[model samples]
Target: MANYKPDLSCQNKFISVNFSEQIQLGTFEYALYYIVENKLDLSGSYAWYDKTGAVTYPPSGMLKIILLGYAHGLISSRRIARLTKQVFTL
Candidate 1:
């Protein structure tokens, strides 16, 4: 067996968020997230045999954020991607 040790410097290098303050009831984002999780079935659309490695978020999550961005008049791909991270992280 190989020995392992924790890195002390990286222990404090993390960002924290307050989920209760970020997601509120009756909000569009919350509603969309709720529908995506509880109401919609997206597993059928995901690939099963793909070997693309790990993704930051699932494909369905990216699609939902992109669609939401488009609905809000965001046409640029970069902008959409940035907004997707921001909105999802919150």
Candidate 2:
């Protein structure tokens, strides 16, 4: 099995957010999250990693971020980085 960074969706901070509640049932974000988490086979992403190294971010998480960026018409790496850092509710 591939080692992954912990899912921080439920982690409490100064501003608490229930991520599940943020993504509504019928939205595109919800659909994308569901398909990537439940349907996609991402084992291929782990093939290049050596388990001896540090735990990696989940491929599903990365894919979701990238796809969401693309969906918002953000193709530039800088814009995507900004999107990840700046955008909370999309």
Candidate 3:
């Protein structure tokens, strides 16, 4: 057996920077988000229906994130959710 100890020095350190500021205005992700939000109308996709209570997220935004994940070959729902969170946080 070999002696092993974990190094914790860098583990607890955190750096804060705005990822939005770092992204160039003309980047593909930015352009895609913009087009999905403004240009592509998804109003017909939503149901003005009876009793689902309330919906928090818009269909267009969710579609954009899902499409982004699909573009990167993240086909599974779980992977897409994880990637969406990671992408949004950055």
Tell me how far candidate 2 lies from the true structure as C-alpha RMSD in angstroms.
2.7
Across residues 1-90, which tens digit of lDDT does each residue of candidate 1 receive? 112233222232354644435778998877876787688777665544254544334545666667778878999989998876686455
| Model 3 worst lDDT window (10 residues) | 1-10
| TM-score for predicted model 2 compared with the true structure | 0.81
- Model 3 per-residue lDDT tens digits across residues 5-31: 332223423435444455468887888
Each model's TM-score, in the order given?
0.58, 0.81, 0.59
lDDT of 2 by residue, 1-90 (tens): 667787777666635776767898999999999999889888788676666667888777889999988998989988898768875544
Ranking by lDDT: 2, 3, 1
Q: Which residue pairs collide in model 1, if any?
A: none
- 71 Cα displacement, candidate 2 (Å): 0.5
Using TM-score, give the best candidate's number.
Answer: 2
Weakest 10 consecutive residues of candidate 2 by summed lDDT: 9-18
Instruction: Say which candidate scores most in lDDT.
Output: 2
Report, for every candidate in turn, its global Cα lDDT versus the true structure.
0.61, 0.81, 0.62
Deviation from native of the Cα of residue 36 in model 3, angstroms = 0.5
